[model samples]
Target chain A: MLRDITIGQYFPGQSPIHKMDPRMKIIATLLYIVMLFVASHPLSLIVGIAMLVLMYRVSGIPMKMITKSLKPVVPIIIFTSVLNIFFVSGDPLFQFGFIEITRQGLMLAILMSVRILCLIAGSSLLTYTTSPIELTDAIEILLNPLKKVKVPVHELSMMMTIALRFIPTLIEETDKIMNAQKARGADMESGGLMQRAKALVPILVPLFVSSFRRADELAMAMECRCYRGGDGRTRMKQLHYSHRDWIALCIMLVSIAAVLLLNRILA
Target chain B: MAVIKTENLSHVYSEGTPFVKTAIDNISIEIEEGQMIGVIGHTGSGKSTLIQHFNGLLQPTSGKIYIDGEDMWADKSKLRDIRFKVGLVFQYPEYQLFEETCYKDIAFGPKNMGLDEGEIDRRVREAAAFVSLSEEQLMKSPFELSGGQKRRVAIAGVLAMKPKVLILDEPTAGLDPKGRDRILGQIKEYHQEEKNTVLIVSHSMEDVAKFAQKVLVMNRSKVFLYDSVENVFARAGELSQIGLAVPQITQVFMELKKRGYPVNSNVYTIEAAKKEMIRLLEKGGEVRA
Candidate 1:
């Protein structure tokens, strides 16, 4: 079950979005998130939703995967929408004994839910296209300017890369430790909150011990291969800005502009 | 009576994913009570998956696993009791040790059974003795122990549970020949004293041949052979096809047979090979003549 819970899972593809530079993808996702918050008008929201759908189509990720990613947020979406529907003050569309459903409340709730959906889908699109290695490479390059201020950008990205690489291995080790403890009759699934937290001690202690051991081994291995931090290090696969990346960034900028213009016009 | 029985058991890992794999496939077998059975297979041949099902650690994908004539998954809540009845020592079990002292670590299983303090202490001491861990050693941190000692402490933790069926995955892995023999000898002694069904999953043909009364050979997620040690080793050629081979002595006997010597190819252990050699020498010493 732990293995099934994919985090920022990548789905490989040969589409333009998949081939786009990770830096552009990261920037576009951030800009898209900002545009979602800025655009309150219904027309602008529609433009945002259309853009997300078009991007998904281009990325070629299955519709099922989009729904799968959204499944976990369904509860949050429902809770927020229900709260907005009841709390917003406006002309009452329906009234039932102190429970009033106003027109503005209904409209706001619908737009808010749609905006949340688009926000999740848009960001997930970036992770689904780019691999973790590429994402970290993009981050290091994007933060290269920060090196002038002694930010240790390369070290930070190296840490990120190592962290991401060890995530799956640690998860697997956790699973093995859990099963080993479970075989010893450690009840993990059922109990009070305190009892359950207590049950995690057996799993966590061994996991931490093994993680430290692995980290030590890895450090020694890197040293054996002449690794000395990120200084004077060269990458085997260099990041480059292709025509596709520029075109994608241009489209993202134009879409943000269109959303802003529509917001002002509708207002 | 069958202590562990599986009917059409199959386990699929990452099912419904693109990387789906059938770890074990349609394995139907029955193990009698009080038998020391050795499960041998190449890596990824499903030996570990099959043993996990015996203790109810893993639910079968499409078949039934019956422990002591009862369907293990028939009552979900009762699986805990089933786990106590079947102790599983996972591969590299030393890495699972986390307690402050070896005594506390060995007592972990019996403590989980809600036993009285006196009973837990007794079982812990008994288990420590079974693994030949000293009284002073029990007071030391398991982390401070040597690799082989830590492995024994982990094994003792499971032994303290005193399950009706004991399953160990690669129990002697990553140990010296003497350490390996000591551990397996202790396990054999434990089996003899308790008369409990024991399943040892290993890669070493010689170790299995030396201790196990029966051998369960797995190949490509299926049961290749489930027979006595002699019968299984008799088909060394088929075993090699699955990336497994008989013991070195058995291979030597097979080679002798190939070169027109009348030695038995079923010689799996050194003692058996020695006896065969003696018989060949007593037959008028043809090469000497």
Candidate 2:
């Protein structure tokens, strides 16, 4: 049942979005998130949503997957919208005991939810299009300037790549261990919260032990391969910005400017 | 009566997701009581997925699994009871060990069954003995033991539960030849002593050939063949077509038979091959260096 997590998952495709430079995708995602916040008016939000739909069409990623990514953040979305309803006071629309719902408050709540949803959807597109390894490489390259101050960019990226690679492995291991424990009559289900937490001791202890073992073995393997991080290292698949990437970056900047313009004109 | 039975059992992993895969498809099998069955398949042929269903570790996407004539999922609340009735030792089980000492690790299963302290202790020691774990070793942390010893402790943990049917998925995997033999020997002994159903999933044809009386060959998430060892090995050509082979010794015998030798191609184990050679020799067959 734990296998449902799709966070940080990439879907392989031959679409333009998938083939875009990871650095460009990351920057575009950040800009998209900024646009969501800048988009205050309903027309701006509509533009934002239309842009997302266009990107989804161009990327060839299923709409279902985009919505599925927003599932985990539903609670946060609700909490923020509820908070905005009570906190953002203006001309009252309705009133209850010690509580007032204003027209501005209601609009703020809707806009806030739209902003958060667009933020998540925009960020998730980056992950969906870029492989974890590519993302790590992009991060390392983007942070290369920090290396002048001895930031250990290569080591950080290597750690990230390794962690990403082991996630599925560790998840598979956990599933195996859980099944083994369950077969021995470990009552993981049908238990109180405390009992369930205690039941996890059997799973967590083994997972931790195996994770350490894997880390040790990985270090040894890296050493055997004569890996000396950052110094005189080269990549096989060099990151290069194509015409498509430049076009994508241009589109993102234009949309962000348009959102800001709409916010000024409408608000 | 069948101790465990499945009718049209099918399981689709990550259903409705992009990663949707039918792990096992419409599998139906009846495992009689006290039968020693070996399940053979290529990797990702749903061997692990199939055994996980026996203990209710996985619920089938469709169809039913019956344990002792009761539908396993009929009363979802009783699934835990079904697990105790059919124990499964997973591949690389040593990694599942987590207790402070080997004793506690072995006792984990019985304790989970909610057995009394005295019974749990007795079963733990008996299981330790069955796996030939020394008394001195039981007190030490499971982390302190060698890889093979850790595997034994893990197996003993399941054995401590004393399930009516025991299923092991690649139990001898990643062990040296001697260590592998020791484990297979102990499992054989356990099956004999307990006279309960034992199902072993293995890639090693020889290991399965040596222990299992009945063989179930799976290919592409479906049962390819289910028959006696001799009958299954006799169709080595069909098995090889599906990326599985008969035992190495059986292959040698089959090769000899093809070369016009009077040898039994159905012999799966070295001992059986030896007896066949002896019979040929007694019948005045010429011996060649």
Candidate 3:
């Protein structure tokens, strides 16, 4: 059941999105986030949503996976939308008991929800297209200028890559540990809140111990391989910005500029 | 009556996703009470998946599991009782130890059963004794124990529940030869003394040949062969083709049989091979040494 978690999950494909440069994908995701916030008008929001739908289709990733990624943030989405409805004041559209529903408030709520949805969908698309290793390489390269100020950019990326790589491994280990405890008659399913929290002790303790053991072994293995971090490391597959990457960047920039123009004109 | 029976059992992992895989397919088997059964298979052959179904640890995608002639899933509320009745000791069970003291760790299972303190205490000591753990060791923290001792404590934790059928998945994995023998010996002794059904999932043909009366061989998520140990080893060629090596001694006997000796190729254990060799030598038969 825990396997249903799709955070940091990558879907392999040969679509144009997948073939784009990782650095461009990261930058495009950032641009998309900015566009979602900038597009306050309905027309611009429609454009943003359409762009997301187009990317979702072109990426060739399963639609179900994109929806699944939003499942975890459902509560947050509802919270923000409810706040928008109650907090935003304008001409009243309707009134029931103590709750006044304003036209502007209603519109703001819908806009906020759509923006959040687009934000998540756009970022999830980037992760779906780029592998974790590639994402780390892009981050390191993007942060390369910080190296002049004595920042350990390569080490930071290495840590990120290792953490991403071990996520599945740690999840599998947790599953095993939980099963082993359950087999010994630990009632984890039905209990009061405190009782349930106590039940996690068996799972968490073992999981923590095993993770430490795994980290120790990983460090030893890295040392044996003569891994010296961040110093004079060369790339096997050098990152190159292709024509597709330039086209993707151009499209994102144009869309962002259009949203800005529409927002100003509508205002 | 069979202690455990699976009818057309099948499990598909990550169903409805691109990662979907059929772990076990249409597996049907009946296990009698008090039988020592060993499960052997190549990696990902569904040996672990099959045993997990016996205790209701996993719900079959489409199938039925009957324990003591009753559908295990008949009452969802009773699944907890099923787990206590069919204890499973997982691979590297030592990592599951959490309680401060070994004694308390062993008591974890019995305590979950809601047994009285005296009853829990009795079962805890009894389980510890069954695994040959000393009283002093039981008082020590489980983390302080050696690797083998920690494993023993983990096994004792399951034994404290006094399950009617015990299923151990790769119990001897990652252990030294002596440690493996010790744990297997304790399991055999427990099965004999309690007369409870035991199923051991292992990759070691020699370990299974030495202890298990019956063997269940799985290949590609299907039961390739399930029969007496002698019978299973007799079909050594088929087993080897499926990436399972017969016991080392069995291979030696097969070599002897090929060299014109009147030997039983069905011999799986050294003791059995020795008896067969003595019988041939005593008959005054012309044998090439």
Candidate 4:
């Protein structure tokens, strides 16, 4: 059940988005987020939505996956929307006993919900098209400036890479331990929160034990291969920008321009 | 009646995604009570998925599971009860430990079962004993134990619940020869004491040969073969065709038989192979005694 988590999970593909340089994709993602802040009017929102739809098409990542990634955040979106709608005092459109829906409040709710949804979808698109390793590579390059300030850029990236690499491995290990415990008749379901959580110990204990063992072995193996804190280390796959990256950059720039104009005109 | 059974069971990971996968297709099998069943398959052959469904860890995409002829999912509210009846000890189970002490960790499952304190203590002590863990060891944090000790504690955690039909997915994986034997030995002891339907999902033909009386071979998300150890191992070539090899000693014995040696080709365990070799030697074979 724990393995079903799809948040930030990459869907490998050979689409245009997948082929674009990770550094550029990373930058495009940030620029897109920056643009979203200024997209207040419905027209800019429509354009932003259109761009996301177009990007989704080009990326070939199935729409179902983006929807899957949003499952856990449903409550968060609802909570934010409710808070925005009820607490934001304005001219009431309808009044009932203790509840009232206001015009400005409704718009705020819609906008906040849409913004949260779009943010999640857009960020998910980055992971959906790019593998974790590629993202880490992009991050390491993007954060390379922090090295002079002793920010441990290499260590951070290496840690992120290792962590990302282990997600699936850990999930697989969890499956194994769960199976092992289930065979022993360890009840995990149909419990109160405490019971359910307690039931996880059978699964978690062995998982942690094996994970630490795997880490030890992995560290030894890395040391054997001369993995000394990533200092002076190089990658087998180098990141490079192509014409497609330029196109992506241009697309991001257009979105930014549209967001600015819409905010100016709407205001 | 089958102790555990699946009807047209299928599991599809990421069902509607581009990375969707049908890990286990419409596969069905019935496990009898008190049977030591060995599940052998190549990697990604749905061995893990198949075992997960035995208990309620996984629900089939489009099928039903009957635990002792009762629909496991029918009482969804009591799913943990089903989990208790059909225990599963997953692969690399040693990592699941997070409790402060080994005793608390082993008692974790029983506590979840809502057993009384005295009962939980009884189960915990029994489980620890079954896994050969000592009193002194139980007081220490599970994190402080050795790798094998931690693994035993993890297994004990589940065994403490006393599920009727136990399933272990590669219980002896990644261990050295001695550690492997010790783990396997404990599992055997557990099965003997519990007398539950034991299903071992493993790729180790050697362990299966020595431990399991019945073998179930899975290939391409299907049940390729299921029979007594002798019957299944006899069709070693079919297992090989599906990327699974029979026990090495059994393979060696078969090779000898194929070369016109007047030896029986049914040896699985080392002791059996040794006995068969001694028998052949007594019969005055031209080969060295």
Please provide TM-scores, in order, for all candidate models, with all chains considered together: 0.95, 0.97, 0.97, 0.84
Residue A53 in candidate 4, Cα distance off native in Å: 1.8
Of the true interface contacts, each candidate retains a share of: 0.72, 0.86, 0.90, 0.62
Tell me the TM-score of model 4: 0.84
- Pairs clashing within candidate 1: none
Model 4, B1-289: lDDT tens digits are 9998889989998766566789888877888889898999888999988888877778889889998899988997767678788777877777667778999878878876889999999999999999899999999998788888988998898889888888888888888999999989999988987888889988789999999999998888888998999999999887888778888998898889888887888999999998998888887847542
Task: Rank the candidate models, highest TM-score first.
Answer: 2, 3, 1, 4
- TM-score between candidate 2 and the true structure: 0.97
Which of the two candidates, 3 or 4, achieves a greater lDDT against the reference? 3
Ranking by lDDT: 3, 1, 2, 4
lDDT of 3 by residue, B88-158 (tens): 99988999999889999999999999999999999999999989999999999988999999999999999
The sequence of per-residue lDDT tens digits that candidate 2 reaches over residues B251-276 is 88878888877776878888988999
Can you tell me which runs of candidate 3 are displaced by over 4 Å? A264-267
Better of 1 and 4 by TM-score: 1
Once superposed on the true structure, which residue ranges of model 4 sit more than 4 Å away at CA? Answer: A66-113, A146-151, A169-221, A228-231, A258-267, B98-104, B114-130, B133-144, B189-194, B285-289
Which candidate's DockQ is highest? Answer: 3
Single-chain TM-score of chain A, each candidate:
0.92, 0.96, 0.96, 0.95
Candidate 2 clashes between residue pairs 3 or more apart in a chain or in different chains: none
Clash number for candidate 2: 0
- The segments of candidate 2 whose C-alpha lies over 4 angstroms from its true place after superposition are B285-289
